[model samples]
Target: MTSALLEQSVVETPSSFRVLTGDRPTGRLHLGHYFGTLHNRIRLQRLGVEVMLIIADYQVLTDRDLAERLPEHVEDLVLDYLAAGFDPGRGTVFAHSAVPALNQLLLPFLSLVSTAELSRNPTVKDEIAHSRQAAVSGLMFTYPAHQAADILFCKANLVPVGQDQLPHLELTRTIARRFNDRYGKVFPEPAPMLSAAPLLLGTDGTKMSKSRGNAISLSATADETARLIKGAKTDVERHITYEPQRRPEVSSLVLLASLCQDRDPHEVAEEIGSGGAAALKRTVTSAVNEFLAPIRARRTELARDRRYLRQVLRVGNARANEIADSTLAEVRRAMRTVY
Candidate 1:
């Protein structure tokens, strides 16, 4: 996607912003990671912006029944991120639980945000649909507030979000405004850096989620990638067209191809002209495999040395603590919680 396209999609603001964004380490990242946020985040760090990546481990409890695999989940996600070129030294990347101060900030933050506001968040509603006991779990109910602390605790001034997450960001901004009003101006109202990447769907054309089995894990073998793409659904018609409304399956393939090859999907469809859905799938699988080759190699190489991966997290957590502690101190003073 061109800068012009992104600019046209979203209004530009002043640069020199501190950024915060992340994911729940429920499992390994997938193709969705590359197109959705990973590539853009790396670019943002290189642009000299201060960046903080949160591994939202605690947030996973909202939907998950057992938290026994938290450590392994975090480890896998960190490795995948490293393989995908997220430099830990250039920016801090740490688990949410690693920084105690972040959770501490939630106490005062909750006082400013209301139950009505939390209930209105779309993410809470969307996630609940996936949970068997969606009606239960206070942790699930209050996730948005915890997310508010995730950004506010680091004093992050900017948050990159998809449109689906705008409601969560709105809650974060609401918390900041309420806190500053009740206490003092201690937190910056975080602004949204809306993503240009569209929501990349899974093989079955549903949202790409681990539970859905439609995701392509970033660490999967080339053969595994080829197998997944080969079986992916396409329209029954032999001819290819880019009309998502009419030919959703074909259009989805084109979108995935465009993301992988960084070329226009419409152009790709044109090049494959009348070759039929089989030809289109072959082209998409090949392009996807070619794109994932280096990432797979990097993942294989990094998986060999587990010690370095642990060290990466250790160092990143310590750096993240420093930032979190500073922000918490200011928050405490603003709320007069200081001894």
Candidate 2:
């Protein structure tokens, strides 16, 4: 039987199915990101869904001390989006810091969610542990509220997320329901459009993350990608196999190749088994480099035309502000705070 979320994707009207998905402008996106969410974003756009991509610049500040390089990070992220086929004409791509209304919506959303509830969020707890912060900031604790504001401000009814993000989406739904019950029905409880894409592991055979320095960046040069994959950690087993439990590192390579070649990882593993890890590495490196060559070239071309890039964001920001303003006006009216 098809899941409710999957059924929603098929039956919902394009005009009614608004999608909101984004990435933090912390660093260049990687292959893991490409397969995980970016690919889904592109598919949603093609399906005529009202897609909104946010550059979560402010969210980056929850853990970091300064955003000195934020501008650069945002620019790079825009280029990656363009190269990955996110057409500005089809969907809006705006920065979180650019929309004032989104921030304003956060105030009321904070009241709906309690401090204890935020503290209990598994995602928040995981991030806190990952950051290893001596003291967690209030902003960090309330990040989920900020995300709810992002979704509700756009009135997005569908949020494309991975399995790891279900808790965050659930919180958004709870806040929406609570607000509507207290004030009035001014928001749709957004549903999770869970991705069916295979999860790509970092070269080190763990979670693909920029902080870990194990990711193959989307903008990496052919040589840089090869170098990263060449030095990737693998097991002592001579033959290649798809035993993720016992040989995660080797299996990660197979998964990468499978994604690149559109073949099964198990088949890829078996095909390269006779040649051992060296052969698997070569296959993975070649597949990844070939896959990224065109994307990198397009990104490099887009980077040179800085004015066009700025205009894309400017247009998207303006439209986003208009939508957000309309939603905020309704919210204020619902709460009887129009004055």
Candidate 3:
């Protein structure tokens, strides 16, 4: 029999189906955020799945020390999530630091996993290489188990992730299997619901990232968008073309405008043929502003209501803890931790 079939006979499955997903609260959301995960979150919530948006603030420390600006960053991140249409009413949006039980799972989970397996993880290795931090911290090294704790704490069944994150999810699944085999079947093997848009590059033709300075923040003012678009590099050919491989710069602007306006970049290129870079930049800038106008307004309004955001997080933490506590209790019983 196949491994899938053989393994199925060993672990008992649960009745509830849930999804766990979130972003680190280091910065604000951007267009890449829209096409990648924000829009999908809205659709998923509508599908009646129990959604949990974890503000992985604690995870942020795996790379950089955000001990000073983290509070502001967290608030801004919350505002961005709210502005992007993640409804607290439909699902839970919580900070990782706020949920002690979720983090508490890490201690027990680490006992179930090994150092060699963690070192083999592609995501962790890549992160270590990118951060260039010599001798990665113990916390950073054991992130996959912590991630497992995040999922298993809530008994999440589905984890929406980009293909790049598949390895990490696999690690989480491995941890779950280990726990089930050694302790008892308490955590589900959370499968990945691959993000629809895999890759979105920055204006600089690199991956859109906050550190790269190419991201157009969701909260960027109209003036900021216009200025950034003006500086956006385009082809020196004096003509607009749709060839991404051949003309990446101009093509990137086209892609940005298309995503902002919900139109085809090829069609946009045709409409702006021979009109040149200036025309394309103006159109793209205007489209971006129009697209983000409502979101910016909503964000401003939401910003004034910090109390609401705190309440939302508090409520979400309570709900998240309830699930986590029950799961931990079950785990303790399975492992015979309780007398």
By lDDT, the best candidate is: 2
TM-score of 2: 0.96
List of clashing residue pairs for candidate 2: none
**What is the Å distance of residue 75 in model 3 from its true position?**
1.4
lDDT of 3: 0.82
What TM-score would every model get versus the actual structure? 0.94, 0.96, 0.91
Off by over 4 Å in 1: 1-15
Model 1 earns a TM-score of 0.94
Q: Please, what are the lDDT tens digits per residue for candidate 2 over residues 26-87?
A: 99999989998898888778878878999999999888767658888888889999998899
Looking at candidate 1, what is the lDDT of residue 9?
36
- What lDDT would each prediction earn against the true structure? 0.83, 0.88, 0.82
Between which residue pairs do clashes occur in model 1? Answer: none
Candidate 3 lDDT over residue span 1-339, tens digit each? 333542242233322457888888878888888788887776667656668888888888887644448877888877898897888898998889988778878987888778898888888888888874556787789889988888889888877788889888988888889989998788889877766573567877788888789989999999998988888777679889878889887887888788888888899999988989999988899889999999999999999989888888889889988887888789889889898
CA RMSD of all predictions: 2.8, 1.6, 4.4
lDDT (C-alpha) at residue 50 in model 1: 71
lDDT of 1: 0.83
Better of 1 and 2 by TM-score: 2
Residue by residue across 1-339, what tens digits does model 1's lDDT show?
A: 344554443334425567888889878899887788998888777776777888998888888777757888898988888888888888878888889988998888778777888787898887787686636599988999999999988788778888898899988999899889898898888878778786677888877877788888888877888888888888778878787878887888888888889898889888887999788888888888888889889999999998888898888799889988998888878778888
